[model samples]
Target: MVKFYQHTFSFEHAWDNVTYAFWLRYPNPFASHVIGCDVIDRHVDPDTGVLRTTRLIHKQGVMPRWGRHLIKNADAYIVEESEVDPKTQTMVTRTKNLNHVRVMQVEETLTFTVHPENPKWTQVKTEARIVSEMRWGLTGRVENFGITKFMDNSVRARKGMAHILERLRHNAALAGTPVAAAATTGAPLDC
Candidate 1:
């Protein structure tokens, strides 16, 4: 079975600043479950000037007691692919878990664009698909649990992004620089 979810939200920050902050979002206070993030590959297109990146993320996950029998550990490895088109002021990202698919698999896509009504703000559209391949009555239970957990995680993830964006805003004000410029300084945002 496949379960789907979608959400639309806006950030009070500009597209450039929001996209820049996305690269620095991992170590934010709201995302303590994320243990590690490493860039697997990254490059800027010479002709298009678009930035593309692949990253690996390690997250300490929570699994229901019943799920313990299906998987030995709750740790999850995720692969993320992202592209940022500076010219178009748009960013798109897709992520999926690399482990524990037999129990459940959740895939999510996110798009960031300049807000139509407010140029200074950015709009984010999130879409997710949850699937479980288990046979028998266990499939329904697992997929239902997957959707519930997904919604909970989504809320926390949004808070994490907002937390990172606020820090960027603060840093920009403190340094008397653009938020994007502050984001480029490679400072760790770890709590």
Candidate 2:
């Protein structure tokens, strides 16, 4: 079975600074589950003037009591691929957990673009898919659990990014430098 989720929101900051904060978001307080993040590869595409990046993230997973037996140790590694097009002012990211696939797999895609209503704000779209390949009648249960857990994680992830963006704004203010992509609260829609 497969489960899907989608949400749309805007950061009252610029696309540049918001994307910058995204790169620095992992270590924030809201994401304590994230232990380590490393840039595996990064380069700018010569023709497109787009920055492409790959990162590996390690997270200390948390599972429900019923899931403890299935996911021993509860540690996970995530692989993330991203593309940032400076010319177009857009950023796209895809991520999936590399381990514990037999039980459940969660794939997420996030896109950031300059808000149509306000150039100073950045618009964000989030989409996720969860699937469980398990059989023996466990597939349904696992998929359901996956969806719930994924939504919870998504909330935490958004909060983490928001925290990082705020920090950037505060630091920029302290340093007395113009924030290139700083964001503030904007019209947000979650569904």
Task: Summarize candidate 2's per-residue lDDT along 13-104 as a digit string, tens digits.
Answer: 88988888888786888888888888888888898999899998899988888779887779899999999998899999999999998899
Best by lDDT: 1
lDDT of 1 at 46: 95
What does candidate 1's lDDT look like per residue over 1-191, in tens digits? 69999999999988878887788788877788999998888889999999889999999988888878888889999999999998999999999999998888999999999999999999999999999999878999999999998898888888998998898789789989988777668775232
Each candidate's number of clashing pairs is: 0, 6
Pairs of residues clashing in candidate 1: none
TM-score for model 2?
A: 0.92
Candidate 2 — worst ten consecutive residues by lDDT sum? Answer: 182-191
Minimum summed lDDT over a 10-residue window in model 1 is located at 182-191
